[model samples]
Target: MELQFFLPMIPPTCTHQEKQVSVVTGKPVFYDPPQIKAARSKLTAMLAKHRPERPIKGKGVRLIVKWLFPKGRHQDGEYRITKPDTDNLQKLLKDCMTEVGFWKDDAQVCSEISEKFWAAIPGIWIRVEEI
Candidate 1:
């Protein structure tokens, strides 16, 4: 017996009304105090140990972590950090670069390193909202 797969059809009117739109006029909010603190702490720890030849540039790992795990409102309507399951994220990044021969023998460009690091992990997402 042969099986057939049918694609679902979406109505034009339904599609048109399903889209969401919003407008706001104001300055963008910055990171929360706790978040900034956590990021700084983590960055400091990483820097103290690694001591890369060049500066990490921009917000460095902390900014990347924030992007990876955004903040959202909780049940009490209070904003909280949506932490990422970075378990072994660092080791995985290093392994990936080594396997790809990008950093097999020595250090690579900071941009390349960051790119490879982010690529190793999938399904990680982050978004920050002001309290």
Candidate 2:
């Protein structure tokens, strides 16, 4: 079976490359940034409402994520085609997917394809399938 969905919101600026933290009791504390946390919450809520009856389970799965960003200086219909970096953006989304139980584990998603673009309409589009 294949799973597909769209997260229709202005994609947050959060990237997994962002570090979360502070310190207490001689130990380093970690947490999501306020913005990142909010974004995760939004993604989680959306996923929970639509997630499969059971998580996708298998030895190999494929994941594709296409992120559409609000047009910058780019002309209409043109891709963002630059940095913020697609890899960085995928990290946060993948982690959120794991947290929302889209699958047994993100690691189970053996193949991944990610991308970003500039568009008049902005949101995230995701697809998953067993391989």
Candidate 3:
């Protein structure tokens, strides 16, 4: 089975973990930044709406993600081959998909193809399928 979806928003890169001394516990704690939490929440909600009625489960699943960024220095339809790299953009998305039951778990996704491009329309497109 294969599932495809488009999310209409500029995807944010994974937020780095921040360590701070807890006021109550007096111990260092790691937490997601408020902005990152909000972004992940939005992404999660978007994925949840598009998730398959029943989650997919199997060995060797493949994931494809295409990110379209609004034109800035790059022209419309240009391949965004530079920064705001793929892995960073993928981290939150894959995690969100896993949370929303896109698959039994992200570990089952054995193959991945992710790309970014400059487009007049900005959005993220994703596909999950059994291989």
Instruction: Determine the C-alpha RMSD for candidate 2 after optimal superposition of all C-alphas.
Output: 1.6
Per-residue alpha-carbon lDDT of candidate 2 for residues 31-130, written as tens digits (9 for 90 to 100): 7777877877888877676677788876678999888888867865676666778888877787888887788888888899987777778888889888
Tell me how far candidate 1 lies from the true structure as C-alpha RMSD in angstroms: 20.0
Can you write out model 3's per-residue Cα lDDT over 1-131, one digit (the tens) per residue?
Answer: 88888889976754433323354567665667777788789998888899888777666689999999888878988999877778877777788888998888888888999998998888999888888
Which should have the higher TM-score, number 1 or number 2? 2
Worst 10 residues of 2 by lDDT: 75-84
Candidate ordering by TM-score (highest first): 2, 3, 1
Per-candidate count of clashing residue pairs (backbone under 3 Å): 2, 1, 0
lDDT of all the models against the reference?
0.26, 0.80, 0.81
TM-score of 2: 0.89
**TM-score winner, 2 or 3:** 2
In Å, residue 95's CA in model 3 sits off its true spot by: 0.4
TM-score-superior candidate, 1 or 3: 3
